[model samples]
Structures are given as C-alpha cells and as structure tokens.
Target chain A: MAEVDEASKPLLRDLKAVGKKFGHVMYPKKSTTLLRDWDLWGPLLLCVTLALMLQGGSADSKEDGGPQFAEVFVIIWFGSVIITLNSKLLGGTISFFQSLCVLGYCILPLTVAMIVCRLVLLGGTGTASFIVRFIVVVASFGWSTFASTAFLADSQPPNRKALVVYPVFLFYFVISWMIVTFSPSHSDGTTDTGP
Target chain B: MSTTERNKNPNSTESWGGFEDNPIQGGGSAVIDMENMDDTSGSSFEDMGDMHQRIKEEEEVSEEAAATEEGDDGEFLGMKGVKGQLGRQVADEVWQAGKRQASKAFNLYGNIDILRPYFDVEPIQVRNRLLESLIPVRIINFPQKIAGELYGPLMLVFTLVAILLHGMKTSGTVIREGTLMGTAIGTCFGYWLGISSFIYFLAYLCNAQITMLQILSLLGYGLFGHCVVLFVTYTVHFHSLFYILWLVVGGLSTLRMVAALISRTVGHTPRLILCATLSALHMLFLLYLHFAYHKIVEGILDTLEGPNVPPFQRIARDIPEVSVALVNTTVKTISATLQSY
Candidate 1:
C-alpha cells in the first residue's frame, strides 16, 4: 500500500511524456530541452507506421516482404546514425540520440504525407490521383525539411550548419521520394502499367 | 516508478538471504529501496570477502528468478563497489546494464536472437531504463522499439494467427480439411470484398460510372470460377492442374465480368483492359496461394511426407538461419563479461 508507483503507472507517464514530446515536434520552436533529452519511442513508433504503410496498408499480404521491411528499417536507422555521427564529428553540440530524436521526430510530417499519399493512391493509377498525391507529398516533404532543419540548424556552428542540414535534407528527401514512387507489385509479367 | 517496484519484486537478493527479516527488506523492497541507502554508504566496503559473498548470493537469485522476471538490475549492488564518481569500468557496466534493461523492458532482444527483427512483435510497453541506451550506436544495432495497437504489430498478429492455424494441424486431410475449407470461406468473403472494392476503385480511376451494388453483384458471380476451382481441386488433385486451372478459371471470371460490363455499356477500351487486368489479378492470387503453400494440394494427401510448410515458416525461411553454435558462443562470452555479480 505504501508504493503506488507500479510498473503500469510509469508506463502511462512515459506515454504521456512521449505524447508531449510529439507535441514539441509538431510546434518546433527553440525546444532544445527536446534536444537535450529525447527518446526513440516516438521516432520508432513513426518508423514502424511508415514502414507498414509503404508495404501496402493491407494487413493480409501474399508477398514475402521481409526484405522490403528490413530495407526501410535499416535505411532510416543507419541514415540517422550516420547523420548523428557526422554531426558529432563536426563538433555539433547535440548528443547522439538527441540528433536521432530530431531526425526521427521530424519524420512525423513526412509520415503523415505518406499516409495521405497511400490513401489517395487507392483512387487508382490515374493522372488526377497522381497529381493530388504529388502536391501532398511535396507539401509535407517541404514541411518535414523545414521543421527538421529549423530544429537542427541552430545546433551547428554557423559555417558547418549547411553540412548538417544537407544530410537531413537527403534523409527526408529519400523517404518522401520512396512514398512518392512506390507502386504495388503486380504478379503477371505482361501486366505492367503502360506509360 | 515501476523500475523501483520491479527491481525489488525480483529482490532475489541472496546476499541478504540471511537478512530477509532485516527491517530494510521486510516491506518486500517496494518503492523505497533500502539498498539505495546501503549503496550511498559508498566509502565503507568491508573488503573482498564480503563482496564475494554478496556476488555468490546474487548469482543464485538470478538463476531462480530468470524463469519468470527479466531484470534484477534494480536489486543491482554494483554501487557498493564504486566509491565517489563512477569509475571507467562502472560507467561501462552502468551503460551495458541500462541497454540490457531497456531492451528487456521493450521486449527487444537484439543481434543474436533477433526474434521480431524489423518491428515490435509485442504491443505491451514497460517503462524501464529503456529510453537511455548508453551503448554506441554502431552500424545499425538490433531492432529495439515497438508499441501497441499499431499496424506493425496488428498486421503481424493477424497474419501470424491466420497462418498458425495451419501450423498446428498434422493429419491426412491437410488440404481438404485444413486449407481448402479455410480458403473457401476466406476467399468467399475476403476475395469477394477484395475484388469488388478493387474494381470499384479501378472504375472510379478510369472514369467509368458503375454503382457499387452493380459491381458487387457482377463480381459475386465472377467468383463462381474460383469456387468451382476450389471444389474441383479439392476432389481431383493434379500437379499441373493448379496452374492450368489458374488460366481457365481466371479467364472464365474475366469473361463473366466483361459480359457484365458489355451489358452495362460503360465503354469499349476500358472493358477490355478491365477484363484482362482482372484475369491477371486472379492469376496473381492463385499463383500466390499455390507458391505460398506449394505441397499441400498435390492431389493425394497419402503420398506426401507430411504437412507443407506454413505461410510464416516460408517467411521465416526468408531469414537465413543463424547457426545455434555461433549464437551460444557469443551469448556465453557476453554474459561472462557482463556478469558483474
């Protein structure tokens, strides 16, 4: 009776904290406390969501997409790690996971864009649907880039800021591009969508 | 925090085995850890013998509680060994412990036993020292994060549950009883819902005006070929009959759909493309089922060795099996090094 702090209790707290952090990413202002201490919880949650959506939002699949999931998972994590290491090597003030936190958290806008793109994609492989998805992806891609750089750029030295932002730019660009270009695989050989 | 409570629950602290009745451990070592007090009294370690005795007791407790709970790091006594600030060894030890505890709490077993490699297999979240990973992120460390009710775990659970139903069955009626009935019921609704929705979406894309009910009833009849194929393949089994039936049934389904399109007078070119595409989609689904569960439909169940590989086992085969011996040796060395007890 003396101890109310049980396992389930902190989990709730942590989730609340995670939710709060997500809010911080949503409205990115000089939130370096976010930079000082960050958890991969939000980032990972976003990563998993993006990965599944990329593979077709269908829960039941007939494809062996082990490689595809692994492909997305590895690219995101490794890209962030390399970006983080590069920042650290350049004497950026941020720690490894703080950089990871910003890099991963900023993926939020892109993730949303991917969801919208996937749903719009369901409207079929026509020019109208394709144009709608393009605008959404481009808008969110810009938002993601702006938000991530806005959060990350201040941490770098004035001259080296471009160096840091470049990778971050590439990182978001690659993911957004993936969302843009992805097409569901058709089984029949001659059934390719004609240009 | 749960960290303190959990740490104490696994108090499997044998050094204090004799001191179980001591006032410090009397309250089941709940939130207020008496060990934290002992750890703070850092200056006085009553020499090597006392530490050895505590270490020996801890190992025994670890073995006992390991079958149930995961971490006893909350009962961790490494604090008494280090005096003021953390030593280099203690720092690394603390980092390693934090990583291990975090992984266990998240249900993430990395590297050697990469069970749920890419995504979180389990949806439950336990707040432990998990947020703080002190180890250097060297070249993509093992998959370590998963949360609940999301698509990664949700789809994984649904697909795994559907497949495991096949895994548990070992009998003479592997196909007829095990897969065929499941396939029939599943394809009846799933395939119907799937194709109709697909066609409706495709119609919208192609600027064809067709009502949902019209498409649904059309596609419902279109499923007759697949239903017939299911029963025919059920009774008479042939190796090539599967693919051969794929062409025939797929064509029939397409023809029925095209005939419905002709009556409706939607358009000319779109009808031809729609029928051909539907045929291709049907072929795709049949090819997937055949290739996915290859051996189960080989006509006579008596001739085959046993049940065919389950869908997930086929997915599992995609992961190159790591040798058990290598895993053991690496695990042994890691445990031996991390055994600060």
Candidate 2:
C-alpha cells in the first residue's frame, strides 16, 4: 500500500461516510437532515407540551363546568406560534410569524364555507348533499393546504408543498364533519358554555 | 537448498504461509501429507469413499459444536441453518399458521395487504429474522433520535386537530345511530392502508433493496383486514360519515409515513411550524362549525317541539287546502322533532 497524506484526510470525512451509509437505510433525503439539529427539536417539544396541556385543561374544564372551547383555542394558538417561530429560526423559507397569521386568515373563511355548505347544500336525500360535501371538503382543504405551503415556503419545491397541505386539509375536513355528526349533543354531554 | 524449496519438496507438511496465514489453499504437499498420514486415509477406492464420509461427518459435528457455543452468546442459528431444507419447512408451516390466525382476527376484513410481509416468514424465524433485518435498518436508515423526537409531537398535534375537527362537525345533532361504527371502521382501514402504502412507497424509493416479494407481503397484510371492513360497510350501506372519516384518517397516516420515509432533509423549525399551525387552524374551524350548527339545530328543534307545538298544530289544521295543511303539519312536526332532542 502507498503512503497516504494524514492532513489531507478530513476528520469529519468518516462521519460523513457513516451518514452516507445510513442514508441508504433512512430513505428520503429530508429525514437525514432532521436527524442533525437541536433547534428543530424545540418547536416539536413545545407543540407536544402545549397539545397535552390543552387536552388536559379542556378535560378538566368540562369536569369543572368551565368553557372548553376557549382553553383549547388558546392551546392551539400557543402551539402555532411556537411552531412558527421555530420554523423561521430553523431556516424555513417562510417567516416566523407569517405561518401563524395564515391560520387566522384561514379560520373565518373556512368556517363560513363549512356553515354555508351545511345550511344550503345539505338535508333531504339527494346527490346535492354529496356534491356539497365533496365541494366543501375539497375547497376548504385545498385552500388550507395552499395557505400552509405558502406560510412555510420561501420558495416551495413546485408541487411538493401541496403534498403536505392537500391531504392534511382534506383529512381535517372529513374528521371535523364526522365528529360533529357523531359526538353526543352538547346538552346531553359536557357542552361547556361558560365564558 | 533455499528455505522455500526445502520446505516445498520433502516433509510436505510445511505449507506456504503456515497454512493459516493464507486462507486460500496455496499449492503445497504439507496438506496432502497431513491427509495421507491420517488413520482414516485408505488406498482402495471404497476406503476413499469412507474417508470422505468421515470428513463430512466431522465437519457436521464441528458445525453443531459451533452452533451450541454461539447459541449461548445469543447467535440463534448460522446462515447454513437458515438456508437448509429444515429451515424452509419450518418457514412454510409458520407462514400458513400466520395466514390462518390473521384471517381469523380480521374475519370481516379480507385481503389486508400491509401485514403480509410480517407473516411470510416461518413463525419460528419471524422474530429472529425481523430483529436481524431491523439491525441494519436501525443503524443505517432509522434516524431514531430525530424520528422519536419529532414523531411524538407530530402525533400529538395530529390527534388534537383530529379531535377538534370531529368536535365541530357533530356537536349539536342527534347522534346518528351508526355513524360512530362507520367512522371507526373507516378510520381503521384508512390508517392501515395509508401506512402500508407509505411503507411500500418508501421501500421502493430506497435503493430498491427490499424485494418485491417483501413489499407484496406487507401490502397483503395491510389490505386484508381493511378490505373486510370495506366489504361490510359497503354491503350494509353503513354511515357515509364513517367512510369519509376513514378515508381522511387513513390518508393522514399514509402521508406521515411518506414524509418520514422521504426524510432526507427534514428542515427542522420550518417543517414543525407548518405542521403545527396548519393542524391548529384545521381544528379551530371545525370546532366552530360544530358548536354553531349544533346550537342552531337544537334551537330549531326546541322551538318546534316545546311550548309552541300546540299552537302550530292548530294553525296547521285550520289551513284551507290539504296540501298547505300537510306542509304546515310537516314543518311543525320536523321543527318539533329537532327541538325536542
């Protein structure tokens, strides 16, 4: 074997090599990067902590005859802000506060659309109900997806952004509808009306 | 004579590189002499056959000894055992048993595709094989620190959004008799299929290392149970709400799996923010809808059914034409029905 230069060989090269070997197993390039950072973890931790706290608070509120809605909303707002700040700081294309603001923008429009769909389009057996539902779900979810992508992107990967947004929005649309249709009537169960 | 030539010609027992230094057989008489000197060695052709048999038996005994020694150290079976006819027979029996058990467990849901890979190996080998396979995956592919750190929060946020949205959709209405049943079934299948496909898709992208047989096996497991649920739901015309719910939940689960699989560069803060905010907004809007509609519907029902019904009934009866009277009666009846609930 020929003698090799010691200095020319980078110390970090071995780590990089190990990472490359691992890259084969992990699949998807994005996941590889996520494994390397500390800042990225902060928002995630915050989001989870807030979610649990909110859930517990809501449950307790219902038990204590306090309002559940406001508490839940506050938790959501808190989580969104933390996530937004984290994304911005972590080098997301989008700004820290913009993502959170987008949520506010989407809230009213989506609510109106859902209400309109239910009031004007639903009731009595017909294809109208189905069409309305499909429209509502697609429109709301589609817009929500766009908003999320825009909120997070400095410049998205063309259509890749939609992958995250569309499916999630549609999922929310359906789940929301299902919960409404199936959960016990507010009066019968804990329908916290307290302010 | 030079040391090399002297060793090569005479004793025949002195091989090049001491026989152990060079793993490959270097041509030398030392090996031949050792074989020739052994008591089992013979001159006749029949004796040669017996010598070969003895050699084979000795190798087998050594292998068994190795296995025993290694087994204590947690090396279950060697590659030779796995590749042997006995291993294949055991694998076949385990596979059959897995299929039967899976089928029974998912009685209504037939043809679940996601879980097939898990059941393909013999029951005995399943855990060992799975563990073996996971070792490389864990070391090479699974970004455990990252995935574990991110996944918990991601799941928690996702669950919250799901719950909130569900709350909004069905808040004030009469609990539809079968909607829950339908939603539960739908969610189960939807998540199962979504996760299964995502895994398959990831496997496809990752070097094509996973065999087609493996992918199909997993798909088979995933789809089998889910399909049964689909069949039951469609056949019985169970609640559409449930079906819709299932599709969404399944899609979400699948989406997450894909994201994780493709995570070559998960941009930390930005991704987290986007995920969290979007989820929160989705939940908030849904909850709003749930409360508003629920209250309105309940109010409408109450107005018709409580206190004001007798007056409406009298008015309905007094209407001149039967059509008008019927319409009035129906309106009052529906209003009452909703309000009373």
Candidate 3:
C-alpha cells in the first residue's frame, strides 16, 4: 500500500498541472481580449433579428386573401430562411440580405412561368366566364419552389452571399401579401360564404 | 540434383572400406555394456535392408524436389519472354504443374503422360471480354452525401402508402375513416416537411449545383397541366379518359425529370429531396383544392335553390349542376395529368 501510494503521488501532481494549464488557456488576460469580438455579439444580434421576424406575425394570414399568392410568398420566404440558415451553418459566408436577393432573383422566372400558366389555363376574360385558375396557381407555385431550389439558389453570387438573402425573404413575404390583396377575389362574384 | 546421380551405386563403399572395417562395424562385443543394454535386439539383417530402402526413398524424394525446382525455373523464364505477360504467367505456372505430373509419370514408368497437351489451350479473347463486361456498371466517385438508391425506393414506397391512405379516406369507408384520414394527412405532411428541410439544407448549407428556377419551372408545368385538366373537364364535360390520358402525360414527364436529374450533375440528396417534395406538395394541394372547391360549389348550390320553390321554377338549377360537373370533371382530369407516381 505504501509503494502504491508513492507511485500515485506523481500522477496526482501531473493531473493537477494539466488542469491548471487548461484553466489558463480558457481564462483571458486584459491584453488578449478584443473590442469587436463576434463571438460575444453575433448571437445576440441574430436573436434580436429573429425576434423581429416573429413579431411580423403569423405566416399563414394570406389564406383568406388568396391561396395562390400566399403560396408564392411562402415559397420565397422559406427559401430565404433556408439561405440564411445555410449561411449561418457555413460560418456566415452567406448573409441574410444576400439570401434575400438570391430569393428575389430566383422568384422572377418562377413568377413569369406562373403568369404564363395563368394565361394559358385561365385566359378567359368575361365576368360570367371566369376560367378555372387553380391549375396555373398550383403549377406556378410548385414550379417556383423547384426552380428556386434548383437554379437561382445555386447561382447566387458567392461574394455578396448574405447581403441578398434577407431581402429576398422579405420580398417573398411582401409579394405574398400583394398577391393575396390583389388576386381576383371569388367573394366578389359569390353570395354563399358558409359551409 | 539429377535422378541419375541418385540412382548411382550405393556399393561405392569399396573406396571407404578402411572406415567400414572398424570394430564398430562388426560390433561383436558389447563395448558400452551398461546393464540391460538392448543394441543386439535393435539391429538385424532386416534392419539393414530397411535402411537401404529408406535411403532409396529419400533419394527419390530429393530427385522429385530437384525436378520441381527445374520445372519452376523453366516456367518462370518461359513466362518472362511471353507477351500478354500476366496471362502467360498464369499459363506457365499451370504448365509447370503439368510438367511435374509428366515427370512423375516418367519416374513411375506409367502410361498417363499422353493427355497433357490438350489442357494447354488459351482462353478465348471474346469470352474474356464478355466475362469482363458481366461486371456491374459501377458509378464511380458516387457522392456519399446521401445513399440515393436506398432513399429513392423508400420515398416511392412512402408515397404509395400515402396515396393508399388518401384513397381509403375518400372511399367513404366509415369505420376506419379517422385512421385513414390521419395516415393520409400524416404521410403528406411528413414527406413534404422532410423534403423541404432537405432542399433547404442542400441549397443553403451544401451549396447544391441545382438552381431554384429549374425546380420551380418543372413544378409549374405540372400544376399548369393540373389546372387545365380541371377546367376542361369541369367546363366542357370531357370524358374521364381525357383525364387518364393527361395522367399518362404527367407520368412520362416525371420519368423524364428523373432521367434528367440522374444525367445532370445533381447530387443524390438534392435529387431525392426534389422528388419527395414534388410528390407530397402535389398530392396535398390537389386534394385540398378539390375538396374545398367542392364545398364551395355545394354552398352555391344550396343558396341557388330557395326553400319553397317548385321544381319547374329552378332557373339556376341546371347551371349549378353544370358548374359542379365541370369542376369535378376538370379536377379529375388535371389530377390525373399531374400524376407522377
């Protein structure tokens, strides 16, 4: 027992020394600290931004306004969020604003395609002859999602990565609101509103 | 090393008779006469003959070894000078084995040496090429981002299950309606959410090679087809076969998309996500749209007919029927056209 105790004393001292080294590395001296440390402030800023987004209200309010317009908005917003997350996940090589720009640019072709679908499927022009427009809406929406994911997002500029991101998401939200507010309301022509 | 040297007379002891004639050779007296010593019992004329036989056996064994060594050396040298070196080397080793067998036959004085030449035929080149081609077509440097083959069939099965559940829910089977409906909703949402998340990950995090425009365009085409079918059938009272035909078109288009995805530089994870999302969103949107539209038309129908109106006085009755029929027909047609699964 005495011999074993003698062997363990050096080991105990070595462990204590290692612990002190670790503590010293972890603790900062005045000279080692920086004024503009992102580690200290970055997350705080992100949280504040996120709070702002949440405060913009539920993303589902376009249901009564226009499902098609709402859908396009959702697609764009979702894509922007993805871009933002992606940038953050990649150590902020991409920014929220850049993702927004990418999102906006991406939605352009999809919107055009959707408009074409609308013209093709619902081109009839009389009040009594309102064409069935769902096909164009759904097709455009689905295509927009696919095109944005596959093409525009892939082609986003690497340098201005995050700068274009947040704006794109906001654009999606705004466009969706516009689509809801402006789409031809079926309510105008119909008297029955209940189940 | 030759067999002939081994067969040379062992009786050449005449040159070494001085050593042979030593008293040790006769051994008449027990020199080391330890009590109960048994040398006389262990030695005899039979033992002498046995010793001769053992020596002969050892010489035969050594001769065989020497022959094999020579055989191997010849095989190696023969292989060195040959074209198609690898094939020749293999053939030479086999030839060495054959030569060994032939040598053994010569040693044994046997007649089994006649058939060795027939085994020397080279393999046919066409046969070899065919054998090579039989190897599986391996996709080299396959991206490990996702196990594509596994995920594809899995997604397909999930979609089928969802479709089955949706069918059951709409089939008016009451007792299991709740379960079917739950499963239908769950499957649709699960597939959509999962695919959407993966797409998000691929676009943002993985920096996928695909563009959003391409994806959206494909989906838009499908939706446009869907809407057209709905409108045509609902408004024009087209037969259900037109819808079926449209569905066939949708299927073919989807297959084309899949082929395109595979041929392009699209990664497996993104492609898989694309497929899953397209399927889920298409199903969810179509189902909801159809049911909701039906309910809207029903409300319109109820309001068009006042409570005390006689059958003859229903001016808008036919219009409601025509409108509902048009919507239903168009829905079915477009839904069929959009069918990828």
RMSD for each of the candidates: 28.4, 24.5, 27.8
Candidate maximizing DockQ: 3
Instruction: Give a tens-digit lDDT track for model 1, residues B1-341.
Output: 33333356453232333432334333344322334433332333445566456445544444444434434653343343233224656887999999989988656312313322222222222111111111112222232221221212222222322222221111111332333324433644576567778888877766655666556545544444544454344334344575578777756565545654544435667756665666677667655544444323221222233323332223323111233343567799999989965
Per-prediction count of colliding residue pairs?
A: 2, 64, 47
Where model 3 places Cα greater than 4 Å from the true spot, the runs are A1-80, A86-92, A96-155, A158-174, A177-179, A182-195, B1-189, B193-246, B253-289, B292-321, B324-341
Predicted candidate 3 versus true structure: per-residue lDDT over A1-195, tens digit per residue? 999999999878756643442232223232211111112122222233332332232234322222232333343454456445433432343334444433343344334433443354255423333223333333444443443343333344454333333333333333332222222322322231111
Scored against the true structure, residue A145 in model 3 reaches a CA lDDT of 43
- The runs of at least 3 residues in candidate 1 whose Cα sits more than 4 Å from the true structure, single-residue gaps closed, are A1-7, A57-67, A185-195, B1-341
| Candidate 3 lDDT by residue in tens digits, B97-137 | 99999998666433322322211212242223223222222
> What does candidate 2's lDDT look like per residue over B1-341, in tens digits?
12232244443222222322222332332233233332222333434454455444434444444444434332222223234535667888999999988888666223333332222222233223322221223232443212111212232233434443333322322223333223433443344345445544644444333443433333223232223233233222223433453455433432342333234324455435433432343333333322222222232344334422211111112112543454588899999999999
Write model 2 residue lDDT over A81-103, tens digit each, in one string.
54443343233354334455443
TM-score against native, each model: 0.36, 0.26, 0.24
Local distance difference test, candidate 2: 0.36
TM-score of chain B of 3: 0.26
Which number leads on TM-score?
1
The interface root-mean-square deviation of each model, in the order shown, is 17.9, 14.2, 23.9
Ranking by DockQ: 3, 2, 1
**What TM-score did chain B of candidate 2 earn?**
0.21
